[model samples]
Target: MAWDPAVYSAFAQPRLRPALDLMARIEPADAARVVDLGCGTGNVTRLLKERWAAADVVGVDSSPEMLATARGDGGGVRYLQADAAAWAENGGAVDILFSNAALHWLGDHRTLFPRLLGRVRPGGVLAVQMPHNHYAASHAVMAEAAAAGPWSEVLSPLAARFPVGEPSFYYDLLAGGSSHLDIWETEYLHVLEGDNPVVAWTRGTALRPLMDAVDGAWATGFLAEYARRIQAAYPPRPDGRTLFPFRRLFMVARKG
Candidate 1:
C-alpha cells in the first residue's frame, strides 16, 4: 500500500510519543550498529542516530514514497528499500534493532519475533513499539464501514484482522532467547483538533488499504459512511477537542 508522508506527518508529534516512551526504557550500553526497521519517513530514525551518534544507523522501509521523503532529509543515515522481515532475515546482526510504530504491519509473530531476536548479538537489544488499538473504535469501525457499503465485496475482504496479539503472547515467544525482557502497554488519550480528526488519523495508517482498493462513487460513499459512524463513536467534547485513546505495545528484549 502507498503511504502519504504528509498525512502521516500531520499527527507527527502524537506518533512520535510512543517511540520516545519505548526508547526511554531501553538500556543499551553502547550501540555500535542500529537498524531502524520500518523506519517510515526516517523521522524517528534520525532521533535514533542522535541517541547513538557514534553508531552506524540505517533506516529500512518498503514504501518508495516514504523512503523518498526520508532520503530528502538524509541526516547522514543510510536508507534501505526493503521489507522489515526480509531485512531482519538478511541484514546481518546489529547491537540495537529498534522499530517504532512498525512490526504490527507484519504478521506471524511466532516466527518474526524470534528471527528478530536472533539477529541481535549477545547483550544487544531488540526494541520495538507497535500500535495495539486494533479493537478500539477508531479501527473497529473500519470493519463496520467496510461491511455497510456497496463496496462491501471489495472492502470486506480487505478488512484488517487484529495483528498485534496480547502482551503475554510476545513474552512467551521471546522468553527463551532473551536474557532480559520487558513488555508493556500504554494507552494515550490524544486531544485532537479539527473535524473528524480520528478519521483523518486512520486515513494515514489503517484506512489506507481499503481506500486504495476502490474509486469512483463507491469509494467516496464508503469514506463518507465511515466518517459518519466515527463522528458518532468519538463525538467532540464540550471544548471541541476529540479524545482519541490509542493503545500501543512496547517490547525490549536483550540477547543472553
Candidate 2:
C-alpha cells in the first residue's frame, strides 16, 4: 500500500519526538558516514546532517512516494530509495545506522538485528525504534476486523504476521554482539481532538494492510468496524478528546 505523507504527518511533533529521543541517547562521535534507515519524509533525517555536519548522511526508504517527499524537504541531505529488509546488502557500511519507527515493518528479528549491526563499522551505532502496540486494544481490533467478513481471505497474510518481537527478544538477539545495548519501552497517551481521532491516527500506520486488501467501499466498511471497536475500547473524555495510548520499543546498540 502507498503511504500518504500528509496523513502520516498529521501529528508530526508527537511522531518526531521518538526520533529525537532515540538520537539523544546515541554516543557523541564524529561519524564520517551516517545513514537513516526507513527515513520517511526526512524530518528526522535532517537532524543527522545537523548533528554531524561533516558526515555524508543519506536517508534510505522503501517507499518511492515517501522518498519523493523526503527529497523535496531534505535540505541537501541525500535520499535513497531501497528496500529496508535488504539494508545490509543494498546499503554499505556506515559510522552510524539509525532507524526511527520503521524497522517493525520488516520481520525476522532473530537475524535482522545482527545483520543491521554488521552494516555499521566498529564502535558505530545501530539505533532503532518500533511500535510495540500489536497486542494493544486498537491493533487487536484490527486483527479481529481482518478475520471477519468478505475481506478475510485477502487480508489473511497481513493478519497472520507481526513485524516486531518482544523487548527481551531484542536484548537477547543483540547483547552477544553489541558493546553497548540499550533497550526500553515507552507508552505515550496522546490526547487527540477530532472525530474518531484514534481511527485517524491509525489510518496513517496500522490501517494500511486492511486498506490495501479491499476495495474502497469494502475498506470503508472495514474501517467502520475497526472504528466502532476502537471507540468502545477508548471512550472520549469530558472535553471530547480521545486518549490513544501507544507503546513503542527502542534499541540503541553499538557494535564492538
Q: Over the stretch 155-178, how does candidate 1's per-residue lDDT look in tens digits?
A: 987776788999999999998999
Candidate 2, superposed: residue stretches over 4 Å from native: none
lDDT of 2 by residue, 23-91 (tens): 999989889999999999999999989998999999999888888988888576998888888876657
The residue pairs that clash in candidate 2, if any, are none
Identify the runs in model 1 with alpha carbons over 4 angstroms from their true place: none
Among all candidates shown, the one with the greatest lDDT: 1
TM-score of each: 0.98, 0.96
